[model samples]
Target: MQIIMSGLIMGCIYGLAALGLVLIYKTTMVVNFAQGEMAMLTTFISFGLLTKYNFSYFVSFTGALIVSLILGAVIYAVFMNRVQAADHLNQIVITLGLFLIINGVAGLLWGHQPESFPTPFSDKVIPIGSALITRNDIFIFIFTLLLMGVLYVLFNFTKIGLAMRASAQDLTASRLMGIKVPLVFMSTWAIGTVLGSVAGMMTAPLTFLSPTMMFDILIMAFASAVLGGFVYMPGVIIGGLIIGVFGNVVSYYYSPEMKVVYTFLLIIIILYIRPQGIFGGKQTVKKV
Candidate 1:
């Protein structure tokens, strides 16, 4: 139970991170390698708001999210949109550049020292089957579920979601259907960044805040996305959970240092057997 809970907690954060990756890819056809950096930067924003500006927690949270929204939108408008027609290599390079730039700015602003993140939940621990877990663990799991629910509803039932879906499915068709493709795409990036920021904020409370804080999370998030398949949102999320649990279990039974190496080994082995990922090779399209 202890192992399971620990893995789930980490998995939830990873899944959130991966979800942001998949979200942009599905709509924009570009993998934002800088997703983690954006998360890290927004987290720093929240921390500064809380620590330096002496703002309330809620204000800091909202302020960070608002900054994330603008950050996403501006990146899309100024950078991603221009590269949308470029080769994948160019897009990847651009995102990597963004990653470097963001990381550098964060370091200059916040330094590399780790600082404790304020936890929103109580520190009380509860036991289940002789295994103890904190309120934050439960909160992470519950929050992830609720967020997924909201996303599911947004993707399935709303006009904006439908437009976004159409844009993802067929960009030219979306334009012909009178949808403002760029606007939809801009919104997608905005939403994707917001998602990543949430993941970043959630992660800080679990570990500590630093400029390089998201390095490990980014690697694990890609692993989760690869494991679950890139296009399937639910699949990537489940993949994250699997990665989290498997990594935790391996660390518990084997070596903590090799957990990441072993986790990728698992992903590679699975890919060897099924190259399309656990959830790949099948694209589900909703026809209206």
Candidate 2:
């Protein structure tokens, strides 16, 4: 139960990150290879605000999120939207280029050293049977759940969400039907970055703030997305939870070094059997 509990929290973070990835892919058919770096950048932004400017965590965090929102929209409008109709290879290359540039810029600005990030919760824990529940863990778990619920409401109840869904379903039809496809896609990117930024800020205290802070989380998040059927919103979170438990079990029973290897191996096995993902619908290519 201890390992499970710990892994559950970790999985929530993975799911949260993967949610951002899925949102962009679902809307624009672009796999953001730079998603992690983008999140890392935002975390650094918050870190700088809190440490250098002496801003409160809440204000700094909100400020970082706002930056992420604008960053997402601007990136799409300036770079990605122009190539929306380009080849998949082009999109992939662009995102990969973004990943490198963002990581490099963060390194130049923040240097290579890892910095500590403050958390709202102290390093305290409560023991429950065999499990030790830390305040940070509880915060992460609850916050992730609440944020995901907000996403649920956004996707199902909001006008923008409905338009986004329609755009995802059929971009041409949506445009023909008077849905602002560009606006929907731009909003998707913006919201996706917001999600990623939140995940990064929450995770930084645990892993420390650095240019590479989101690397492991990003990998696990991708694994989670793939395992849950990359396009299935709800199943992605469950997949992340499963990954958390499974990865932690391996780390505990074997070695931490093998955790990623095991994760990749699991993904390979799953893909071999289910190319469309466990919860994803039939694989179909649609122009963005």
Candidate 3:
């Protein structure tokens, strides 16, 4: 039960992070290698707001999300927009460059030390059958579920969401339909960044705040996204949960160090058996 609970908590975090990556890919066709670093940077911003300015946790959280929105817009306007017409490799290289730059900036600003992040949730341990878990764990689960619910409503019942979907499916057609494709693209990045920030802030308390802290989680997030069919948004969550449970089960039964190895092995096996991923749909072939 303990291992299962741990996996679910961590899986929610991975799902949020993977959502950001998949969002960018769906809209801009770019695999954002910088997603984790961007999240780390925003998480540090929240840390600074909490520690340096002594803001309340709620205020710091709101401030960090606002910063994330602006950062995402600026990045898209100044960097990603310029490479929009480039080939896939060029676009990917730009994201990789962003990954490096964000990491360096985070290290320089926050230094190399890991710090304990404060959370509003109580640290008191609670018993669940034979397993013990912190209140924070339960809070994290509730928070993630609420967040996903909000996203579902936004995407399903909002005009901006409709525009984003149109833009993702057919950018040229969206423009012809007067959808302001550029604005949609910018909004997509902003939304994705905000999601990433939420994941980062939640994860910091579990894993300590540091520049390199998100790298490992990022790997799992990538695995999750790929496993779920990178273009499918909701499937990312399922993929994350699967990866998380698989990792935890492996760790419990085998060596903890072998968990990551086996997780990737699982990915390879799953992909080999079902190349389109668990939820990936049929691909459309465009014949010349």
Candidate 4:
């Protein structure tokens, strides 16, 4: 039961992490490989606000989100926009370069050491039907659910969300309809960065803040996004949960290091069986 609860908490974090990847992939058709690095960098920013500036969790979280938004916008404006006409390989390479650059910056700024993070939740545990659940785990689960709900509402009910979806479907048509494509793209990147930062800040209490923290998680997130068909929100959540649980189970039964290996194997098998992924719809490409 303890293991199950732990998996659930970890699964929520993975899902939230995957959410940013899905958003960027859906809107721009470019996988921002620097996503994990962005998360790491934002986590450090949150830490700085919390420990150095003596800010409360809420204050630091808000500051981190704002900074992440600006960083995302700047990244898209400076790097991604230039690659709009480039091929997939070029885009991937550019993002990869950004990934390395951010990682180096993090190391230079924060060093390679891990730091403890404080959480609002107490360390007390509650027992329910022979299962023990910690307050931190409960907080993580509840916060992730609330975040996802807010995202759903924003995407479904907001005008900006509608424009984003339209831009994702057809950039030219959306532009013709007077939608600002560049702004939409920038907003998408900002949204993705905000989500990633939120996930990073939340997970910091459980995993600690470190430069390499996002590397392994990024691979897990990419697998989750790919398994869920990349762009589907529900599918991404489900995929993350599946991978999280499976990895936990494998670690419990086998070795912890084998989890990533098994995940990659699962991804290869899934790709072979269904290249479009579990929830991906058939896309018709219009020839230029």
Q: What overall lDDT goes with each candidate model? A: 0.92, 0.92, 0.90, 0.88
Q: Candidate 2: deviation at residue 13, Å?
A: 0.8
Q: Candidate 4 on 38-106: residue-level lDDT in tens?
A: 999998999999999999988998999999999999999999999977999999999999999999999
lDDT-superior candidate, 2 or 3:
2
RMSD of each: 2.6, 1.6, 1.2, 1.4
Q: Write the per-residue lDDT of candidate 2 for residues 1-288, one digit (tens) a residue.
A: 999998998899999999999999998999998999999999999998999999998899999999999999999999899899999999999999999999999999999998889987678889989899988898888888898899999989999999999998887789889999989999999999998998899889877888989999999999999999988998999999999999999999999999999988998998899887889878666555
Best by TM-score: 3
Better of 1 and 3 by TM-score: 3
Compute each candidate's TM-score over C-alphas. 0.96, 0.96, 0.97, 0.96
Query: Between prediction 3 and prediction 4, which has the larger lDDT?
Result: 3
Ranking by lDDT: 1, 2, 3, 4
Clashes of each: 0, 0, 0, 0
Relative to the unseen true structure, what is the C-alpha lDDT of residue 143 in candidate 2, on a scale of 0 to 100? 88
Give the C-alpha lDDT of model 3.
0.90
**C-alpha lDDT of residue 120 in model 3:** 78
